[model samples]
Target: MSLRRRIAAVAAGVLAAPLVSVALPSAPAFAHGYISSPPSRQAQCAAKTVSCGAIQWEPQSVEGPKGLRSCNGGVAHFAELNDNNKGWRVSNVGRTVTFNWVFTARHRTANYEYYVGGQRVANISGNNQQPPATVSHTVTLPSSGRQTVLAIWNIGDTANAFYSCVDVNAG
Candidate 1:
């Protein structure tokens, strides 16, 4: 190759190397998951039962640091999920409610937890193993009336977890 052409080719490769490295790793950092059955807030957004922004396109991407209580996993764009007055539909159910989750990329799980009124009601251990594409847990409602259930999937291999909130009217 000519000297000028060889130098130009090497320069282009060097400039693009960092961009490729940075982009590839982030694709797997997103542990995609969310509660689907009973229609968690994101699920509602995906179904268009509720109007939303970017979350409507990715119902399973609500990931954040573990121990967060926010429905949007503290993601700024997903703040709509944290809005209590967003016209979210509430499911009518008996005391026993079954929460279901769907995952696009299943990670090793630490556990799955459920909260009602900011208090924990159920914690199903994942035994520090990867879960199936779908999982379910049944927990009895602690009180009657309209309630928001926060379901969290704690990933065993990472410090992040997936969060979802379901509105319900337990009779």
Candidate 2:
């Protein structure tokens, strides 16, 4: 190769190195975040009210067989609080309570929003800046009793969908 061509090639290689290094080889990209769920074990609601009991929440990947998969470069997981055989009945007086939904994401930014009973509650943008993990916000349940909680990715429209009931007795 000519001297000028050789120098130009070297410069191009140097410039492109960073881009190449950052590129992922074969993994599919998906948006990611956290989701909370009703406990796997059965339980009773709080004495007179339907409050969610003490929960050991954990982060996990969002995966499914069909359309329920995670978004680009992302994984989805759930936080589970069980009922302990206590049934959650909707409050007849229309009371309100606050619950928290925590989450994390992988590559790309984590833009997430929380919804309860079809109403928007909390939201966060640009959450995940580094790779292999990024923690977002805690979504609050605005009302009480058997509300369907949704964690939506505002960026790519992905979601960790779950239906959990909030009891009036849980503190």
Tell me the tens digit of each residue's lDDT in model 1 across 30-115.
Answer: 45899888999999999999999999989999989999998989999999999999999999988899888999999999999999
TM-score per candidate: 0.84, 0.34
Against the true structure, candidate 2 reaches a TM-score of: 0.34
lDDT of 2 by residue, 1-171 (tens): 999999999999999998998895867434233432222111222232334333222222333222231221132222223222444443232333333333344434444555555566766675554323434344445555445444444433233332233333222
lDDT of 1: 0.92
For model 1, the stretches where C-alpha displacement exceeds 4 angstroms are: 1-30
Best by TM-score: 1
Q: List residue ranges in candidate 2 displaced over 4 A.
A: 1-33, 36-105, 131-136, 154-171
